[model samples]
Target: MINVIIVPAFQDNYLWLFHRQGSDAAYAVDPGEAAPIEQALRKHRLQLAGILITHHHADHIGGVNALLQQRDIPVYGPLSSKIPAVSRPLADGDLLTLDGGEISFRVLAVPGHTLEHIAYFNPDEHLLFCGDTLFAAGCGRMFEGNPVQMQNSLQKLADLPADTTVYCAHEYTLANLKFALQVEQNNPALLARQQEAQRLRAANQPTVPSRLSLELATNPFLRVTQRAVIEAASAYNGRPVDSPAEVFAALRRWKDNF
Candidate 1:
């Protein structure tokens, strides 16, 4: 089994460390800072095998150079002109095998939050390391991409197995759920999830790796086709839902201000 450790960094960013049991080889997803990661490696007595870059965001790849100086670990990432030093440029449908274990992952070009954003999926492990694309109860802001692209990206992730464990890069669940509640206050699933998140936060615990099923039930972005979300977006934007794309656009606009 893969043991995952979440190293909190730079306010809300999470650098995920993945390693198999009875092995010293380790892999990190989005090491925004090198100091903490280096310390963690020493503390755990593990060797860095590779680095996975989700995007060119400084908050995601700021520590690549520092980490590389410590060890010549291979770096894999999406094809971005802005990214200077990716050893392996990955594309959609590419498979990455790590360790001697039967571990394999597929690359998904999920753009929207960023034009070159990508997500890594390990079907055998039912794990997804989606940088900023899909968040618990929310989605990323359309910074470099449009609502249509983001919607398509989200749809692709939503089609994953219900039990797929989603590992997002930030701790935005509480804020995202607050917005979701405003949109779907009557949704019992969302309400219960909010309460659970509150409890976890009260105890100083991390609310992450949320299941895909929960997101499908409560996330407003994922429910764009539902009547409640469509009506809410239309009413909020003062526009009629001519199609799902319009609803998505309006929802994205509302969330931008929200």
Candidate 2:
């Protein structure tokens, strides 16, 4: 089994450190800053084997050069010139094997937040490390890609096994759930998830690594096809939406203002 350690950084960003059990070498997903990553590595007594970058955002790749200066390590990231640190630029449907092949991930091209954004999915472990793409209940802002790309990307993730654990890069569950409630106030799963997430946050806990099933059940972004969600989107759009992508576009616009 692969173990994961959460390294919180810069307000809400989470740098995921993962390794196989009994392994001294570990990998970091989206290390925004080097100090927190270095501290976590020392505390866990694990050497940084490699770095995984999901996109070219500053907060995701800011510390890559610094970490590489300490020790040369392979930097795996999207196949784009936006991030020059990527020594192993991966493409869609590519398999990434690391840590002497003990850890392997399928590169999924999930371009919504950025044109080159990708997610690493370990099918055997049922784990997903998606940086600034799919959050606990919310997804990243469509800074580059359009609603169609974002919705399609999220669908690819939603189609994953229900047991998959989502390791998103931010802690935005409560806020996302609040907006979700506005769109689907009568949803039982959304209410339950909001209560649980509130309890976790009140106690100063990180509400992440949520199950794919829970996201599918409660995340408004993933529920564009649902009647309630489409109704809400149409209400906000001032017109009826005919397709799931249209509903998604309207919902994304509403959430952008919410």
Candidate 3:
């Protein structure tokens, strides 16, 4: 089995460590800080195989050089810009295998958070590592791409298997769920999830690895077509929800100030 560990880094960012249970080989995803990752590797007695980067953001690739200083590991990421020391440039449709037969991941180009943002999917494990593209209850801000691009990117992720586990780069679920509750106040699933998240946070626990089915039911950004979400966005924008694209734009604008 593939064992995944969350190494909290840089305020709220999560550097994912993946390894085959019973093996020393491990891989890290979006390691923003190398010190913590290095420490974790040494503590677990694991060997770094490669690094998977979702984007070129400083918070995501800040520790590439430091990690490389320790080992000559292959770095895989988009070809959009300089990625520190990328040994292999990956694009959409790229397939990567790691963790000694425990994990096999496929890369999908999911832009909008950034024009070059990509997500890694492990079909066998039903896991998705989406970096700032899709959050638990909300989507990423349109810093580089437009609402349409972001909507398309989110839709691409939403198309994955309903049970796929979503591993976001940041711990923004509580805030995102609060915003979602505003738009979907009557959704019991959302309300219950918010309560559960509250409990988790109160206990100082990690409320991550949410299931795709839960997101589909409660995430406002992913529910643009739902009647309640469409109506809420219409009320917020003072316009009719004529199309999915318009609804997406309105929701994004609402979340910007929300």
Candidate 4:
């Protein structure tokens, strides 16, 4: 089995380390800084096999150069010239096979948080390492892509199996759930999730890798078509929204200030 461990960095970023049981080599995804990652590697005593880049954000690729000094590993990222650290430039439909196919991933171009953003998914494992494109109870801001683009990108992720374990890049669940409650107060599943998330955070635990099923029920960004979300977005924008993408834009703006 592939063991996924959380390596926290830069206040909220979650640098994930994936390795199989009894394995000495592993992969690091979005290592924002080298210090904490180095510490984690030493503590776990695993060798860095490769690096996975999701976007060109500094917080995601800041430590690439530093980490390269320790071990020269193939850095896989989107087919964008912006990220020079990526040795293997990949795009949607590409497959990444590591350890002679012991671990494999299907690349998905999930642009929204950035125009070049991408995600990795293992169908057999039901695991999704979606960078900043998706969050537990929310979605990323439209930095370079439009509302329609982001909505469509989210749809791609939502189309995955209900049991898909989403490993997003940040620990924003509690904060996002607070805003989610404001959007859909009557959502019982969201309320229960909030309580559980609160209990987890109260004990200094990480509230991540949430089930896609739970996110489908609680995430307002993914529920723009729902009656409550539509009503809330309409009210917040002081106008009526005609389409799901329009509602999504309204909710994103509302959350920016919320």
User: Pick by lDDT: which candidate is best?
Assistant: 2
TM, every model: 0.97, 0.99, 0.97, 0.97
Residue pair clashes in candidate 1: none
Candidate 3 runs further than 4 Å off: 99-102
| C-alpha lDDT of residue 157 in model 2 | 94
Clash tally, candidates in order: 0, 0, 0, 0
Off by over 4 Å in 1: none
lDDT of candidate 3 over 1-258, digit per residue (tens):
778888999888888988888888888888889999998998889999999999988889998889888587788888865575777788889888775555788999998989999999998879999988988787788889887788889999999999999999888889999999899889999999999999998998888878999999999888999999999999999978747778999999998888
Clashing pairs in 3: none
- Cα RMSD of all models vs. native, in order, equals 1.1, 0.7, 1.2, 1.0
Residue-level lDDT tens digits of model 2 in 1-258: 899999999998899999899998999999989999999999999999999999999999998988999798999999888899999999999999999988899999998899999999998989999898899988899999988899999999999999999999998889999999999999999999999999999999999989999999999989988999989889999999958789888888888898
- Shift in Å, residue 98, candidate 2: 0.7
CA lDDT, every model vs. true structure: 0.89, 0.93, 0.88, 0.92
lDDT by residue (tens digit), candidate 1, 110-207 = 98999999999998878999999999888888889987788899999999999999999999999999999878879999999999999998997889
lDDT of 3: 0.88
In lDDT terms, how accurate is model 1? Answer: 0.89
lDDT of 2: 0.93
Residue 7, candidate 4: alpha-carbon lDDT: 91
